[model samples]
Target: MKIKRAFIGLSVLCAIMLCSCSRTPGGIAPAGSPNGQASSQLPTATPASGSSDLSQSSRPDASTATSPAKPPALTQESIQIKLKQMTANEKIGQMVLAGIDGTTMNAQTKALIQDYQAGGIIFYKVNLANTRQATELINSLKDTNSRNSTPLWLSLDEEGGRVSRLPDELHKFPTNAVIGQANNEKFSFAAGSTIGLELRAYGLNMDFAPVLDINSNPNNPVIGNRSFGANAKVVSRLGVQTMNGLQSQSIVSVVKHFPGHGDTSIDSHIDLPVVQHDLNRLRSLELVPFAEAIKNKADAVMVAHILLPKIDATNPASFSKTIITGILRKELGFQGLVISDDMTMGAIATNYELGEAAVKAVLAGVDVILVGHEYEKEVKVILALRQAVKDKRISMDQLNTSVTRILTLKSKYGISDQKITEPNVAKLNAEVDKVMKLIQ
Candidate 1:
């Protein structure tokens, strides 16, 4: 009777071991099995606090089970996966950067986020009242976009001096000209970093600033104080420093009016400004700062509405393939985002229809169209882009390429739809004061 009992006990122990070996840990099905979609179906559990035994924790009998390894975030493969998941409208929406109408969330602005799926919003003085109001407005916008697949680029022309957009509460720093006048790389970088910190405190991700344009034309209306100064080397060095400063604080610095807007006598905002400089002049003078910024890995470039008769006679730089694709992309080897200046501006609106201009801008290799005014015009541009895709005026390959660049940039900056907390005005101002002293 004792021998038989020992035999049965040994057999039961063997059976138990077989069952344990057959069952997969964490209830995950074996690979290629009918229920083996572990990546999507399985729930990952965390080990208990202070638990140090990873091997024991991974045991089938443990209270918590480890998760399968996930693919690295924001990889090229990962971005491509996301790109494949997006719809046509979603892709087109990522190419637009619209303007909001008020200081608070309005119905029209809400639609732009929810219905139109605009990729970004540029704030003007009218959209901001105070630091608290601006933070709340930005947070609300971010909250509303929480359901979006991608984050919005809350941006503005915070170039300081006359182009300043921050409310009365924030410390207004000197313009690019003042920083350029100082001609100190360290000061320029600190100035950019402070501006970036200020923008961050308000939850802004993009600044259309650190004007790379050289102030070659004293009589130039729009870019006089905005430019860093008339010297190419100084502009190049300081512009790049400022660009690096903003980038250091995780703010995207979009070096603007590419191919040089410094020498134009007229404002592109009011009308098409014509630059008579040829390729050689542009390379030597106008393109110097931009080229320097590009070398330092600039995130985005805002194309100007100025027309270079020598480069492309029929089209402005914003809608010329030769300028955007050939000059900026091919010749300069810029692999970053290409943003067009607001299409609703006088330069574009006065000449081409809003819809047609947007389409042409995309065809010219512009990635994001800034429609900074009018809900009707913004909607028109989006619809026009959609129709263009359908009619093949903008091919799917081309559309995907632009959207890929946009997503890659957004990912690179670690942009999120998650709302940020209200800024600490006192604390931020104290930080800005330190930077102010450096430049002063």
Candidate 2:
């Protein structure tokens, strides 16, 4: 009887050991265990809302899971940090927006990017041939600038009527005069949007456009058809709409010839034209559109070479601290970028030495000096700016402020050095056709 009882006890002990062996080591089932009985018996976690039901093998392990890091936000502090890292030459480069000679990238252009580190390039009829050629040239320029710290502003006048610089293949819209005559806000907006769209399609990011100068002077030689209209109210209303439209397409529209270029009898491209208006006169007529533009958040204002002697007795608007910093910035309260009209224009070139004028413009709060001609002149202007900074003619604080503005604008416009594919002329034209219909 004792032996039989001992045998039963041993048999029961062996059965218990066999049951334990059937389970996985940690009281969990091996995934493919027979009948999946152990797995079926295991407790299941309820899935959270909007979460997919994941199997144990597919779920990420908390210990090893990781998330992608986000890029730092662009802010004043971040910009300051970037500014701190830039060299004097790089900072100076940010202030120059130059023009090249050829239709394609050449040694001079390459040096501008690699050596001078020019901030921007404005293309003209000389630099464009056909759609494909222009696109290739622009892409090449961008490719060359890829190694540089900041992107180039591939820009053109492209104001649609007489001032357009687009390739022959692209369709041209009516002049600002025609659009202003139409006096249709919707049509004006569409026009600006269409222009911006085509410009962006060609990888050009800036348009020196929407001549805010009211065609007040019937005999104004330079701004004849360029002005929106003779009436300030009309210019103001349509100008703002056009500006908004261009901005809609992510193109920076530079409202030009600020403090008004409408009343000048002489073409500023040839000689300096004086605006005899005092502050009150400007506030009433000439400054109406500009004031309105500023109220509507103008991105940039191009100061003309036209001298307002009554306002600043000596320097042209582009070089006058009273006009740029005092009037436009302080009085009009314009905080956006201030660009100078082409320094190579006869008004400036014939009067002031290129280098000296550039320094004066910088000191006067002009953020960008547009040197739209001659490689030699561009180089001289750059060297002059460098020397000025070194000699304390242009203070480091002032330099930083201007560079900060330039970089901030570049950031705002999402400017990049990435190469663009060939533009589809047909597609762009088709869109432009739609806009033309509206204006017509």
Candidate 3:
């Protein structure tokens, strides 16, 4: 009887040891072949806090488990310190991307840069003569702000289909529609890179190309071929690819007409176009491309002057706090620059005074106030923005945020290796020819 009891006790001890070896310390089965079944399919007991068996993803209560810590690359602390050192005028100036009358640096252009201390300059067809003249003209404009820490954003709408400010002497690239029709994102990227190389060669840092708008509506006036395609997925893929290509060549790619200008028949240049779609409709179709661009770290986004009644009925997107701040910045998670469409456009300029529009834009979370084709209006915009700040209408924090983004962009792509001189048109044209081969 004593021998039998000792054997029975040893058997029980072995059973306990085997059971314990199969389970984790928390009394849960190990994460594989629990009960001879796949661990993934079998529901297991919740792991206790600080349990080694639980993976970072499996821990329900862990804060750092679901999301890993992101590096502080674009920290606001350094930008905030720089913002504090800037003068009120400098802050206001950084918010303006002004347009000049002539290709050559005339007195008006001089004042816009030297006196007004404008942050950027956008060139138009009237400002272009030839490649050589364009290069010389851009160089002269750049020289005005050589002393300033942030160089002016020498930009132009070279979207390559219907919109192009580069003289005809330069090789012409295909439109977004042609690229989109190819149904290959690599082609779009090549197009952007080819155009970017030519633009950079001319000493132009910013190219307002790769229009993110979807060509959903065939009858749309201003953005037909300028858009990628009618499909949101295609637009999203091509837009991001093109933007990446432009930025790769050190060109500041400014994707334009945000919140979808594809379906609008009425051009904002003539009058304010309104979108009656609710937030759901926009998210499904229009906002898709913009979201992708934001996800891919686009350098800048230009807000449209159109109004979305469901989003913000009172103000156009460029001047709507609900759209820019609440939607674009907060919901969409776009931390880069938010540039306003030309304030002189008939959408806002015809409906509201330029000065008031500028103030409203700043308050609405616009970083750069684009006053194209009107120097007087640009001056008024600068003054009104400054006055708004002084009167506590626009917070200093808001102003700082805009200036910080502008400064950050300038710091990244502002410095060019190409000297500001007469550009080699033959070499640039040769590069453009090679880039155009993708579409051919």
Listed in order, each prediction's TM-score against the native is: 0.83, 0.83, 0.81
- What are the RMSDs of all candidates, in order? 13.8, 20.2, 20.4
Which stretch of 10 consecutive residues in model 2 shows the poorest summed lDDT? Answer: 40-49
lDDT (CA) per prediction: 0.76, 0.77, 0.72
lDDT of 3 by residue, 1-440 (tens): 33233323432443354343222211112222212321111011211111122233221221111111111122244445445656788889989999899768899888988788788899999899887788778877766665343457788999887788988887777778888898766666666666766676677778876798988889898899888889899988888877876775557788888888998989999999988888899889999989988878787899999989888888899989998898898999998898898888889868888899889888888899999977788888999988899999998888887888786665445342123556566766666676566556
List candidate 2 segments past 4 Å from native: 1-73
Best by lDDT: 2
lDDT at position 186, candidate 1 = 71
Better of 1 and 3 by lDDT: 1
- Cα error of candidate 2 at position 437, Å: 1.9
Instruction: Residues 1-440, candidate 2: write the lDDT tens digits.
Output: 33233323332433354343223111212223232211111111111111122223322221221111111213455457557767899999989999999888899999998899899999999899887889789989887776565678888888878898998887888888988899877777777767777776777879998889988889999998888889899998888877877776667889988878998899988999988889899889988899988888788999999888788989999999999999899999999899999999999989999999999999999999999999999999999999999999999999999998887776556665545567677767776776666655
Write candidate 1's Cα lDDT for 1-440 as tens digits.
33233323432443344343222221212223233211111111221121122122121121111112211124465456556766799899989999988889999999998898899999999899987788789988987775566678889998878898888787777777887888877767766766777786677879998788889999999889888899999999888877887776667889988888888887887898998999999988999888888888888999999999998999999999999999999999999999999998888878888999999999999999999999989999999999999999999999999998887776556565445567666666666576666656
In terms of TM-score, how similar is model 2 to the real structure? 0.83
| Cα misplacement distance, residue 224 of candidate 2 (Å) | 0.5
